[model samples]
Target: MNNAETLDRRALRKAAPVVGITEPGYADHSVEAGILKSIGAEVRLLRWEGKRDKLLDMLPELDVIMIRDLPLLDREAIAALPAGAGIVRYGVGVDNIDLDAARQRGIPVANVPDYGADVEVADHAAALTLALVRRVVSRARQVDNLKWNIAQQEPIYRIAGSTLGLVGFGKIARAYLARMRAFGVDDVLVYDPYVSDDYLAQYHARPASFAEICGKAQIISLHAPATAETRHLVNADTLALMNKRTCLINTSRGGLVDTDALAAALKDDKIFGAALDVLEQEPIGENCPLRGLPNVILTDHTGWYSEASVRSIQEKAALAACEILTTGVPTHWVNRW
Candidate 1:
């Protein structure tokens, strides 16, 4: 090749395209740089917080971004970014990403549904179930205070031979059923009209109407997804069906259970206690009533996070992003094509 042609190619190589990653110093990721290089892309990871100065400087070279609760991808920010830059959300839910706006700009948004979280979530629900049935949280303090009480211990229930009702028959619900089988929970009732009865039977679970499940189970675990139809699946009316000593577990979306209704049910001892891994609003405000309630066991949504899960998440999430950016198709994506 001629020297002039070689110089032109060198210049083009030096001006490699940049891929933006908003979450700087990712916890368990190693694939980002290699993936970027393979596609003739330059990588830039940032912790930008809608800062005008910093964003303006980085905007020109960026052609793709990995969004992790970063700047809103609304019309304004979309207009502000360099033309032809697409976005990829890290996980299953894409509510944070502005899909309509991205679509309008010819920028595709992507999400990975690498759902290893199912088992962990079911385990979390079972943990809550054990905590509630044994009054683990409730009885611990009294013992610590050296006040041995009999009546406080009398209501403690046994999980063995008890009925476990699942409100939804998603992946998590199946995992929960798998685990509950070993717990001596012979009667597993599932409530999801979409799943065929024969399909559920393979999981060792029987189909039950929502009302029947609500009224019968000694332990209830919610595994429904967040949808327009299931905004408040467990409302006051359904909650009222639960016997006084029933235990409720919700590792599913917080909106699945009406918070106010749950608080009322807990206060009234309508259900013996509840074990919730989610709340109506995450990073739940300090003034939230459930936080103060003693009978309830509250965990800050850690059901989807674990050491191994984090590494898997980073790998799968990176793949999902790269897949969409290069191929314009999300392998684990949820929405329309």
Candidate 2:
């Protein structure tokens, strides 16, 4: 065919299949554009918030969706998509994605099961732990308001003397422990039956039972992922076991902690204040009860949002997206290939 005829034929044809993004605020480095040019593929960013009601409507014509929240493709949502489109989770945790639904539909779900992403969360956990113990946010606010009586506004609890209990001995938990050691904390206890003794000894972590970690430690930091067994792990009963002076810190998956029970405990002063970067809900609204409390240092679900870390996640995710779209082989499929 002549040049004009060839152009017309392709123009009448559908644009190549694209890789769509479910999350917003990623550094767009033309990786998608490059891949599309290399092999008749396109990449689009949807940037939609996946609430229960509107998730289905937000998804556009997609060959593949690279998602941060794994559970974005529930049975109802997945049913809304056309066949042959794949599902790819950009990050490690697949708790939010409906694996059974994807498996049933033969839609491959992928996740990069790596420690790199978890390290950012671990570092964030340490930051939140120290911020809570040192009352950094409240102190900053007091100074900003020109009422610089920090000691009166928010008391500084000594972390150096306190014991820090880690719930899970994963990569992030180990990172938090290293940060703690730097701060001169000698009492670091961990409660993960899965973590081997040699690794614990190497990290200078004392292996404690769950009850011991909750009861004896002055600060308890959650480092577990959101699994069926871990949902609301820190419920009313577990919260009751916590030291009255304990400060609960979580940078792990939100479902790991019970928001309702934690809110109640914070209200009643059953425990010291909490420092949380992850909540059961993302894009936590201003009206969220936790937002109204001064005792709780709540972040806007941005624990894993450092420039360096997010860049790495986006790069790998983009590559993974391209790989699936081009090769028909979903890299890092989380639901057992």
Candidate 3:
């Protein structure tokens, strides 16, 4: 190699852009890092540890940013980035990211809406519903404590003839419906304004209002998004409408159900039991009243996870980054400039 050619290569290498990953909780970033490296881009994983100042300090150096649902990227965070830098969300929800701010800055934002997690989420919802309906978790704890024959104390109902209510009839909700049907659930009531009557008929699920589902169904599963209309959809009034034999399951967004109202209902036995995967405040707030309820089941917000799904989301997010770096536009761009 001649000295002139070597100098040209050095200049090109120095011109390569940097991609930063903020507040990453994934086990590894080899896939994303490899993708960025392939494009002659440097990859930096910035574990900010909830320090906004540290994140702000690093943003000016980045050409693209990939983040999960942590250390909120609000207006301040978005403003810290150099103009035209792209942001790629790891998963479907972009509520955590400030899309309007990104749009105002002419920075494109993208999300992986279909990263193959519907099966996992649906399976999780069904698992939580079944566990709550059968009192599995409580009974297991009782057995561990050497308590015997405690099942008779709390009346257990048959699941075969019960009515199942789905709050949203999206892909995940349809998957859940199939699973519930396997258990011989006779009636399926769905409440989704966007879904058509023909679609409900195709699944043999009846279309009903949200209030009707809350009042009439034996098992109500929430699969709605977090929006102004859906926020606190299941509040005190809806909780009151629920039958005493009903078991509520939420594997969707936490904002769909009001935690305070649910806590009150559970305390008074207004509803039979409730299972929740996502909480309004993650890690659960210190004052969360649902913590010690015997009739309530709680799981970390991990319903949309599996070994395969994790890899898929990482690859898709990385691909979005790759697209942005190569063409100044992502394949799944959400915030159009």
Among all candidates shown, the one with the greatest TM-score:
3
Instruction: Report model 3's TM-score to 2 decimal places.
Output: 0.93
In model 3, which runs have C-alpha deviations exceeding 4 angstroms? 1-14
lDDT of 3: 0.86
Tens-digit lDDT string for candidate 1 (6-29): 224324433465677775436634
lDDT of 3 by residue, 174-268 (tens): 88888988999979999999999998999999999999998899999999888899999999999989978989999888999899999999999
RMSD, each candidate, Å? 6.1, 6.4, 5.7
Best by lDDT: 3
Every model's TM-score: 0.83, 0.85, 0.93
lDDT of each: 0.73, 0.73, 0.86
lDDT of 2 at 215: 88
Candidate 1, residue 299: Cα displacement in angstroms equals 0.9
